[model samples]
Target chain A: MGSDRSARYPDGGDTGTDRAPRDGGGRADTGVGRRGFLRAGVLAAAGLAFGRPLLGESAADVVRMVGARGPDDEMTDAVREVLKAKFGDRRIQTGHVQLDIPTDAPDGRAVPTILDIDLPITPNSYVATYHLLVDHNPDIYLAAYHLTAGSGEGPIETRIKMRRTGYVRAIAEMNTGELWSAAVKVFVGLNGCG
Target chain B: MPSMHHDSSRDAPTLTFTMPAGAPSSVGEAKILLPLSVARDAVIDVRALLVHPMDTGFFRDAEGNPIPAYFVNAVTVTYGGEQVARFEWTSGISRDPFVRFPLRASREAQVQVVWKDNKGGVYQQAVDVKFA
Candidate 1:
């Protein structure tokens, strides 16, 4: 549908900030809910070395954007750093809960795709939100589709951005308040519609 | 997903989409495969993959500041005068978004995908699948 960030998939691709702090357990400290994921505003203070529990008041103050460069550039680095600091020790299993993306986008804009939460989900264990990420996208945390009993019924769908070529990831947040993720790399052939 | 959405004017706007070669289909696998290319009327299978940035435009800028969020607002797909799928979602979308689904296979139907940006820009694609 698109060439640039919205090329392949109509909604674009994954791209989120890798800011915030790491948990003592050494796993990437991601917000399982509205609580802690990096808001696009936190990139400014991210280098200040804020403590764990990213969304808290002490970690940052919502910084107003001052320029045209989108935070998409820092996403992969920030996410990877935090993930290593927070989840370096866990052995993540590759399953339907996670999704991989292909490179060589025909369009950078919307890329069509589906993420299946194949993990058995019950009322107490259903996935709350499916976290989507892309390494080379503008940001590492592409998008987190928040869901509940009404939306979490199955594989969620949407379009995201892709600045260039990179890897895409899918993470599922369980009702128990834990995070699980899977990722795949992409080899882009050219800039989308650029 | 691609097609024509004609207004009262009668000449509908067309749609289009494209993807890189050999990109991975699923995350962690590191590679996407594409072999499902069937004829429009053959009733076969279809598989496709695409890259996405989906920036919320809410992140900070070079000076450590929050940038405005920018994202896609709509998506439409069609094959042979029939609407196959459509999506209207916000940013918060993941990277390298991979979509694998089934459809009533065809070749001449003309597959097109279109995305409308938050700022009112439109990006589209139209592919004539001739998998005879």
Candidate 2:
């Protein structure tokens, strides 16, 4: 299941990227999809207004255009920037959170990682949000898993793309407003930013 | 439409899947594996798989035209009508992704898994959470 194959999904539903669903059924009631659509539209408009090259020749070029931080700078700045923006002055203690990933990944397209939290998940106290950040990837905020008390205390296991050799950090936000974190370093031969 | 698969291993959990009513397209197939029987308050591992391309805009086709990003944006898990977990993803997720997590068996209810793509396509499946 963790194989590094380049197989793509069939083009059966690939024709609707540009068109917003006219009738989204339940989606129309929640309005969540509308928010996502609006955010994407705003970002696209900003890119156009600035007159900057929105498209890139390659994944690396795309990353460079998004943000141009030196490799050395990313070694520390990547995690720090996210921490400053998310946690701010909140203390992010380590150790309660743990991450399991391969030390050397031949293909950066899919590197499986498991997240385990040594905390309780009850109605009063639980991990509300789990953030996975890639220190060197084009998009540092790789994914976020929102959990509720009903989720039952369980380890989150999934695969992610890594652009290069860097730290993949997992930060958990508790319902009590506490933050916990853990990180793992991985080396990737072929970046999967694309 | 929904497809079902049975496990060969006796220890493997039984999986039940059902598509959401009036879903737009058969965007993809999704499967959720949970044990058929579990002790009260027992913590068990639940594995889920969704068939997706997870395309990044950087990729091009044979004609050298950009594929345009089309990926699963989020996956939500609900237990007996209450949300248990929601995973927000980007193009960074792998193709045909499999996500495994630990789930505590507290009662007999329905376990539903939904996958929402970037283009507002939603695919869902559910299983009965039976306790031993």
DockQ of each: 0.08, 0.26
Model 2 chain A lowest lDDT segment of ten: A1-10
| Model 1 docking tier (incorrect/acceptable/medium/high) | incorrect
Say which docking band candidate 2 falls in.
acceptable
Task: Return the lDDT, model 2, position A162.
Answer: 81
In angstroms, how far off is A40's CA in candidate 1? 52
Candidate 1 lDDT over A1-194, as tens digits, reads 01122232233222222333444123345433443333423542553444222233232222311112121222234565645654564443334464534445565555655677667755466666666666554445555545444234455544555545555677676767666655555544433212
Stretches of candidate 1 exceeding 4 Å from the true structure: A1-76, A82-100, A190-194, B1-132
Cα displacement (Å) at residue A121, model 2 = 4.9
Q: What is the lDDT of candidate 2?
A: 0.70
Query: Tens digits of per-residue lDDT for model 2 on A70-180?
Result: 111223444567777877767766558878899899878889998878886677987788899887676788898898776636688999988777778888888899887
Question: Which prediction has the highest DockQ against the true structure?
Answer: 2
What tens digits encode model 2's per-residue C-alpha lDDT throughout B1-132?
Answer: 001222222232222122357743334888889876678778777889887777767656666677788899888888878878888998888777788876677888888899999888888888887876
- Candidate 2 ranges beyond 4 A from true positions: A1-74, A120-123, B1-27
What is the model-wide C-alpha lDDT for candidate 1? Answer: 0.47
Local error of candidate 1 at residue B16 (angstroms): 16
TM-score of chain A of each: 0.50, 0.59
User: Scoring model 2 with DockQ, what do you get?
Assistant: 0.26
